[model samples]
Structures are given as C-alpha cells and as structure tokens.
Target: MNPIVLWFHKLGSPPYFDRFAARWAPWGHGLGLLLIAIGLYGALFRVPADYLQGDSFRILYIHVPSAWMSMAVFAAMAFYAAIALVWRIKLCEILAMACAPIGAAFTLITLATGSIWGKPTWGTWWDWDPRLTTELVLLFMYLGVMGLYHAIDDRRAAARAAGLLAIVGVVLLPVIRYSVVWWNSLHQGQTIRLFGESSMDASMMWPLAWTVLGTKFWFLGSLLVRARADNLRREAGKAWVAQAALPAVAADPRTEARP
Candidate 1:
C-alpha cells in the first residue's frame, strides 16, 4: 500500500486515532488561536478604515471567516458522509457526525455577525435576501442533521441516518454560494477571489488570509477532538479502552491507598 494510504488505514483503528488526535489537537488549536489573534490585531490596528464603512468594516475579519467555515464545514461533513455510506467506515461516520455541532456554531456566528454588520451598513438587522435566506436554511440543515443523529438510539445507525441527510443537504451549498448572483440581493457580491485579483486592498486582505487559515486549523482540531471523544464512547467496555484508561488511573494520587 502507498504510505499515505497505509497511514489513513491505521487511523481507522480507534487506538491509533486516539493517539493521533491527542498528539495533534492541541497544536491545531494553539496555532489557530495565535493566527486569529494576529489577524484581529492587524485588521483593527494595521489596516486603514474603509473610506465609506469606516471602523465598522473591521468586523469582516471575524464575519468572513465564520461565513466561509459555515459552508466549508458542511461540505466536509457531506464528503465524509458519502465515504462512510459507500465504504461503511466507522471512523468516517463518527467524523461526519462530529462535524455537525461545530459547523452549526460557525453558521450561527456568521448569522449573528452578518446581522451586526448589516445593521450599521444596511440599516436593518434582518432581511430575506436570497443569500441571507439560503444561509439561514444552511443553519437549519445543520440542526436537522444533529437532531436526527440524536433522535436514534443506536449510535452507528444514527450516524448513518444523519449522514444521509448531510449528503442530501449538500444541494443547499451551491445555492447559498451563488444566490447573490442568481438574484437581486441586498448582500454584497464577492470582493475576494483566490484565483484572480481581489477588489480588496492588500493591507486589508492579509488579515483575512490569517483568519481564514486560523479557522481551518481550528476546525481540524475541533473535529479531531470531537471524533476522538465519540470514538472512545463507542468503543467503551473494550479491552483497548480499559488499557487506555489505566495510565491515567495509575497517575492519580487519589488512586493510591489511604494512609
């Protein structure tokens, strides 16, 4: 097997995954937070205020990253769901389900931040614009997946059911992405482009790049941590779990004899 494939195959083992997650989760989280802090500082202090929007535009550092993650995480969940369904990989199922709450959180941040930004810019807290409406629907889709997963008694079965919904709900992603262009929408059109020139100035764009990278790292950490916990729960009562817990038990002073 290819080295990459072999490594991935090893990750399917709960024990290997537990170790892998433990090793990397903190690194992902720490780096993510550091990058976000740098990004925010640059956004607030380094970049000049927008000619029209003024200081209020600084919120984009947070808003755009959250908005991007909202959709990106959902797309990742659906991809994992597809693989789990096709290959019956338990790790993929756990990963797909684990993505729900985190994705929902990003969606919520996007909505809230968008609302805050809009109030000053658009003079309204809410609107039924196509982009905004589709984004709202995206939140509901995430909630629905989470709700469906918990409603079932069997963990594996619940994951499968919810994974199916995730796959189906992916149709909303493209709609949300293109809604501004497809209709007369109050939401602003894209200003940043990965492939071509962005309308935003370089100074303003740098902070956004930092924040975007931060969110990706943060999501990776969150996913590994969540999936590791779920994997441990699903594998409870097994020999490996007992062995895994032994070290912690041995290290606890409370586990020593009462003198």
Candidate 2:
C-alpha cells in the first residue's frame, strides 16, 4: 500500500485517532487563537477604516471568515458523509456528524455579524437577500443533519441516515455560493479573491487572510476534539477504550486499587 494510504488505515483505529487528536488538537487551537488575535489587532489598529463604510466595515474581519467557514465546513461535512455512506468508514461517520455543530456555529456567527454590519450599511438588520436567505437555509441544513443524527438510538444507523441528508443537502452549497450572482441581492459582490485581482486593498486583505487561516485551524482543532469524543462514545466497553481509560482511573485516588 502507499504510505499515505497505510497511514490513513492506521488512523482509522480509535486508539490511534485518540492519540493523534490529543497530540495535535492543542496546536491547532493555540495557533488559531494567536492568528485570530493578530488579525483582530491588525483590523482594529493597523488597517485604515473604509472610505465608504468607515469603522463599521471592520466587522468584516469576523463576518467574512465566519461566513466562509459556514460554507466550507458544510462542504467538508458532506464530503465526509459521502465517504462514510459509500465505504462504511466509522471514522468518516464520526467526523461527518462532528462537522455539523461547528458548521452551525459558524453559520450563526455569520448571520449575527452580517446583521450587525447591515444595520449601518443597509439600514436594516435583516433582508431576504439571495445570499443571506440561502445562507440561512444552510444553517437549517446543518441543524437538520444534527437533529436527525441524535433522533435515533442506533449510532451507526443514525450516522448513515444523517449522512444521507448531508449528501442530499449539498446541492444547496452551489446555490448559496452563486446566489448573489444569480439574483438581485442587497449583498455586495465578492471583493476578495484568492486568484486574480481583489477589489480590497492589500493592507486590508492581509488581516482578512490571517482571520481566514485562523478559522480553518480552529475548525481543525474543533473537529478533532468532537470526533475523539464521539469515537470514545461509540467504542465504549471496547478493550482499547478500557486501556485508554486506565491511566485516568489509576490517577484518581478514589478509583485506585486498595489493599
């Protein structure tokens, strides 16, 4: 087998995954927080205020990253769901389920921040703008996946069912991405681009880059933590879980073996 494939096969083990998550999750969290702090500082103190929107536009630091993650995470969830449904990979199932809550959170933040930014720019807190409405529906899709996953008692069955929903709902992603282009939207067109020219100035773009990278790292950390917990839950009573839990039990004086 290819080294990469072999590594992934080893990673499928619950104990190996738990160790992997424990070893790397903190790095993701720490780096993510640090980058976000630097990004916010640059946004607040380093980057100049927008000529048109003034300081209110600073909210883009939070709003844009959250909005991007909202879609990105859902895409990831759907990808994992597809893998699980096709291959019956337990790790993929856990990861697909884990992505839901985090994606929903980012979606909520995007909506809230968008509303806050809109009040000043659009003179309204909410609008049925194509971009905004489809994003809201995206949130509902995340919630639906989560709700469906927990509604059933059988874990593997629930994951398969929810994964199916995730796969189906993925059709909404392209619609959300192109909504502003397809319809009359109160929302502005894309200003920042990874390729070609961006309408945003370089100074402003740097901090936004930091924020975007931060969110990705943060999501990585969150995914690992959530998946590890779910992995433990699903593997409860297994020999590996017992072995993994032994150290903690031994460390607790009350649970220690006594003569």
lDDT string, candidate 2, 1-259, tens digits? 9999999999998899999998899999999999999999999999999999999999999999999999999989999999999899999999999999999999999999999999999999999999999999999999999999999999999999999999999899899888989999999998988899999999799899999999999999999999999999999999999998888888887884669
Candidate 1, residues 1-259, lDDT tens digits: the string is 9999999999999999999998999999999999999999999899999999999999999999999999999999999999999999999999999999999999999999999999999999999989889999999999999999999999989999999999999999999999989999999999989999999988789999999999999999999999999999999999999999988899998897658
Clashes of each: 0, 0
Q: Which pairs in model 1 have colliding backbones?
A: none
- TM per candidate comes to 0.98, 0.97
Task: Please identify model 1 stretches exceeding 4 Å from their true place.
Answer: 256-259
Stretches > 4 Å off in candidate 2? 252-257
How much is 25 displaced in model 1, in angstroms? 0.6
Summed over model 1, clashes come to: 0
